[model samples]
Target: MSKPSKSNLKYKICSLLSLFFMLFFLFPSFIHADTSLQGYKEVFQDSPIIPFLNKKESSKENNKEQYQRLEDVKVVPGGQSIGVQLETKGVLVVGHHQVKVSEGAKSPGEAAKINVGDTIVEINGQKINHMTDIKPIVDNSGKENKKLQIKLKRGDKMIETSLQPIFDKKEKAYKIGLYIRDTAAGIGTMTFYDPKSGRYGALGHVISDMDTKKPIDIKQGSIIHSSVTAIEKGDNGLPGEKQASFQTQEKRIGNITKNTDYGIFGILEKEVNHEKYEEAFPVALSHEVKEGPAKILTVVDGEKIEEFDIEIISSVPQKSASTKGMVIQITDPRLLELTGGIVQGMSGSPIIQNGKIIGAVTHVFVNDPTSGYGVHIEWMLEDAGIIKPESNQNAA
Candidate 1:
């Protein structure tokens, strides 16, 4: 080819230089992210994150916070659902002794008569007190078309049922498509307890499937000792998340009583470290929380009590008509740097107004961490079995 002229060559060089600058400035924003994420740097600081290779820290803490064990969860008089993703295989019980079933098949996952709350008592004449005892019978039945008879406890009555086997292509063997869980796991904190009645509540929301995002069947959501791995603070623009390792501990911390927008309720099987408990942080009256300054007691940032400044943006006595009665404006910087502001896993944090706990931070407006939802303590207290739903009733 003939030699290119100087003018043409310079033009080509300028064009290439312009293209390089454009790519350097704009490609990152246009590049599709392999993962959907929310985090914060400084304002106007647009640095890209290089994926870190280190594994997150383990979640268990040998030192528990000094907490006050209340007799009952004070009544906010509100309520909430259940899908919990389970890893280890176990006899799947839906609620309070309900076992789930599939449409057809005679094996582990089959049987139409079995309802969600029926408790599986025995499998193939073997006592199925726990999951380990139940899975093999179900698995073997699927593989060989073996007839597996399952004896279960429904309410108080004992019933025996058999499931036929079928092949499941997903497992490359005979299968019944039944999800199983001995219990669910998550990173949640206790909100309050009632000393008068021995009722307590924690994790101010329903535990659900991370994937399907559906509430786990209540029967399936018995608590387990969850290991919280990492924690981020709640902040103005970003939200916080408690990364935890799911672990199963049979030590019953408590029994679930109810669930609502205020959170879930459970009664302690026995008193937790009573000495470790300090007095409960009282919730504030809606009428008390105002448009000035307030603080939040949060477990974000590794279970430490980090306080933040926020404005009671607007007080809607019944905004959700479910839980939080007031709205807030998160105006803290440190919290914003950690959690954009009320992110997942931050639900149930007590919003202290005038030194009294008024509400639990329930949700962060997706686009705005500075603004989010709060459930009134009164409703939470009622749902947690702290008091009778109609406590202020006239004597009959």
Candidate 2:
């Protein structure tokens, strides 16, 4: 080949440099979207609910000042295994199946333009609070040959539509052709418990429906005792998991009052004993978190809470609330050997550094099982109502 022109070579170098810079800035966000957090599997069960949170915000300056004043707030770090059961405020529309009727098979819900992830809050002017509440109204409407007016909550918008129930010849019951669920149950470690407020935070992330992938709009929920029975070690491209069972007979330790982007928050009915740290301690703000050695409290065997060493590979002082505020890697040989790094059901395991709780493990890197994401403790506290509750509310 002939020698290339200097101008052509310069242009090629510039293009290559631009590509490198673009990938450098874009790679982390891409990884964030792929990082998987453990603990959002739906289990059929009964659960409780949470109250509406005030999401009004003050000015940014006021917000900073308010957070500064919250430095003295103390919380008991939680690492005990717990079972979470959440019931949706109204029955959720997860999917639609064909209803076999005398006329033929059809889906009334799909025909009505009721999409999956919609929450049916009312039917025929009657409020729908449970799956049981829907059947009676549907049956009556079908018998009366009347179209039912349905009110649904889709995201932040409330809309209405008409849906006619079809009579099934085989079962002789009216059907809407929508598969719905009211409750979701799973296992996770608790992040913190504020004794003074009886409020606790856990999971370090939202509980989304497995099918719809939307946050569960809880009517009520409960957190019961749980035990870690087994672990599936993590590996490249495959995240590990903590296999656990709920202590059903044991009284619920707390009631789930809120499910937000940060985590689940609720009022504790009783103290969660068996935590590694018995006494309440201060929490480091996002700005206070640093890149250094840290400890994480979690359960690898049974109900026993144990501390494992980890390192804060990087920490960011966030001006806005975010779930991935810190990058962490498991440094303890025992933890690495036993679990192969962060696993499912360990999302809310508390991360302590320099005697202060700084954050909780939230997600695991799919490509590197040894490293994961940590959310700043301040955001969890805010979600738990232990600190500034009026601002930055993204509750599910």
Task: Compare the candidates by TM-score and give the number of the best one.
Answer: 2
lDDT minimum window of 10 residues, candidate 1: 76-85
The residue-by-residue lDDT of candidate 1 on 1-396, one tens digit each, is 999999999999999999999999878766543222222222112321111111231222212222323332233211111111232222445532213335533334444466654556677888654556655676787677687777766555778777665655545554444444455555665555554334655555665544435444344234433444566654545666676554344544455645445667655444333222345555554555677677665544333445677777776543223655678877888766666666666666666667566677777776676688776666666566443445412110
Where model 2 places Cα greater than 4 Å from the true spot, the runs are 1-68, 101-104, 389-396
Give the TM-score (vs. native) of candidate 1: 0.55
Which one wins on lDDT? 2
Candidate no. 2 TM-score: 0.79
- Model 1 vs truth, CA RMSD: 23.5
Please list the C-alpha lDDT of all candidates, in the order they appear.
0.53, 0.85
Poorly placed runs, candidate 1 (over 4 Å): 1-134, 139-164, 167-173, 195-198, 219-229, 232-239, 244-257, 269-277, 280-291, 318-321, 392-396
All predictions: root-mean-square deviation over Cα? 23.5, 21.0
